[model samples]
Target: MLPESHASPDRKRRPFLLLVLVLVALLGVGGYVAFQLGGDDRAPVANEPAPETDQPSTEAYQPWFAGYTDLTATPVFTFETPDSESGRDVVLSFIVAATTDACTPTWGTYYTLDEAVEGLDLDRRLARAEQLGGQVIVSFGGLLNDELSTGCTDPARLVAAYDEVIDRYGVSTIDLDIEGGNLRDTVAGERRAAAMATLQENRTAAGTDLAVWLTLPVSPAGMTEDGATAVSQMLEAGVDLAGVNLMTMDYGASRADGDSMAEASIAALQSSHRQLGMLYRLAGIELTAATLWTKIGATPMIGQNDVAGEIFSLADAAQFNAFAQENRIGRMSVWSLNRDQTCGSDYVDLTRVSNSCSGVDQGDQRFSDVLAQGFDSRPTSAAPIKTTEEAGQIGDLTDDPATSPYPIWTEGSTYLADTQVVWHRNVYQAKWWTLGDLPDAPVLNEWETPWTLIGPVD
Candidate 1:
């Protein structure tokens, strides 16, 4: 219930001040994962399982993966509960592990003098989130960092490194934010596609699923030639690419001087949908435009952008949020949750990068709150409250599958009041109509959700 013990009821309010908050935004769960610090330009050398024996490997895969799952679903809420400025309750945090180094993968925003603070104690924070049943998705290859494709040139080792991260974090979804040189590198792109294909196949064989999202820079017009090539590489390599998340802010050279940021974002997404469907046909996997829409996402820089004139204000976020809901897009995110704050009075420059806060007037969590409103489908981590009268009516439900009296507890499945079903080996009954939610996987938000888990079959 609210991740007991991490913070007191009256905890300090500095959003990224606490060490734990900074340390583990999207990093691994167990503890601080020590990485070999090398220059951002350094490509990975294939270190045999010999030297780094402790780093996850094929021989030790099972145990490490078990530890990862034990910690899954909970760490989704990356930051401390949103500050007062957070306009709405946060469901999922886009805990950006940016420009993540391809060599050793520091799994944090790579150090930048521009940032006010580099988050620390992330392992602890993530652990608390897991305990709370929040969720997190680790993003790789930010605009700043050398992508694994560029850094880890060797295909086998690249897959190994990616595999290690997948097992270590137990992340069901991972984002590859390919941009800049890495985005355009045709050779590296091929390697990335191949490695991901292998990784996806391996996970599926293990009875788990891995969703791979490609986050690329986009403009009001649409994906650049290179961007389209990058997506095509994955599809051609058979990487069951989950979605394409467009960076709808900082249109840079592509913006039509004075286009509305929201309009640009919508156009970018619309273009991506059409472009992606065409790619599917080329690969002989025919998906209609409606089907392709589900394979798309949007991530806007919450406030001011790197470009002087291009700003994605709160209004833009609201419009984009509504669009996402209307389209039923697969995912939605803010560029960096760390910067969700207002500029202090003395700090005049909004253009410069500041890690501690957003240069805009979001007042901490406001951007998250406003954009995330009505996104009520997120699985909760809050504990349930019980009452005497209703508790007396509890009873065991049936033991049939999805085809039985009640359909199975599938994600996005809606149920009316008093609907019942079975999940895993457990029985569940919907207290009210609900849909697009897990059966509270971690059982963190027991009091909420229409589906109530009634324990395993006798």
Candidate 2:
């Protein structure tokens, strides 16, 4: 159901405000073509020179989820906090990775579960947790690894493999984090659609609920052609797709001041919502906006991302949760739990992959903590104020802070044009009447905003 905040007749759906939160406006038809040609999320933006890879990575979390994945044996982590396993709604990540066996999908870490040995038994641990009334959602495929569909090419074998994973775990929901190569593979994608359609049919006949979610790369502009095609194939195959969980991290984007991850994510999800509606219509299915939004999920890589400049900070997570609560998104997830930690002073590999540590400063489960804020209930408040400040002021706007009388730039407070305020030891003037934008933050849309940094207060 749509969150009560957006439930009223006067409210607008906040789909992009919550999910993926990776909004990038598409410029033209040419941009659209370029997007479709490259379905993989890692593709470099056209004319946007790739940031140098060798730069030292940022290592500090500044925190989400009480839910995390203990993917390895050496770390030996557990959800000891009350907010974690027993309290809030949680989705455990990643079930199986690429395998040589085409017909059978096996469990265990195909990637770093930390520096720990092969002794980590996720199944045993999860089973124990489940017994205590914990909810665990199994995810397949990963950004850095190959998935079953990529390896198991045959339609029959893929269906069996998928069923085995679900049946083995006794899970009703499953996520497919398709990226890199497999995401672009039209053949595998089609086969996956066929296999799932068949599986859904059989499950329906047996009175079992199998909700399938496709986790793919997304931007504010919307899904690339490849991503749209992915949904199209699934809809065409007659599969009742549960949702589209977007990987909102590592966008390689650095939003301008006044813009935020929340805004960006909202843009991306809104675009996806429109695209999905079109595809569904083409497939002889018409879904309402609210219904379409309920099928969107946001999965952000906590702390520092693989892309150097992008960092989803603790503050970002707070806004994200608030937005999600206000909008009632389908689900929220972080990357593997193994990486949520603070690296020691000696640990200098800032950008390298560390399964045990998130490469950001984090408490045991701080990320999970923030992520669990409103997992079960949607908010009843007003919609998230999208812009903080604009460029046009209606009154006498002064450049100096002492002469110009105004209040501190508080989030959600409305300021008229030419208004001045203090923020983060700096003074700023509103270009126009602005609300909900923070003076210290980056703006996703560079074209317009409410703030212009004046000068340091004397």
Which candidate comes out best when scored by TM-score? Answer: 2
Candidate 1, 240-287: lDDT as tens digits: 776677767666555565778787777667556655654565456754
Q: Rate the local accuracy (lDDT) of all candidates.
A: 0.51, 0.53
TM-score of 1: 0.60
Question: How many backbone clashes does every candidate have?
Answer: 24, 46
lDDT of 2 at 156: 79
Q: Which ten residues in a row have the lowest lDDT in candidate 2?
A: 2-11
Model 2: lDDT of residue 389: 18
Superposition error at 273 for model 1 (Å): 1.6
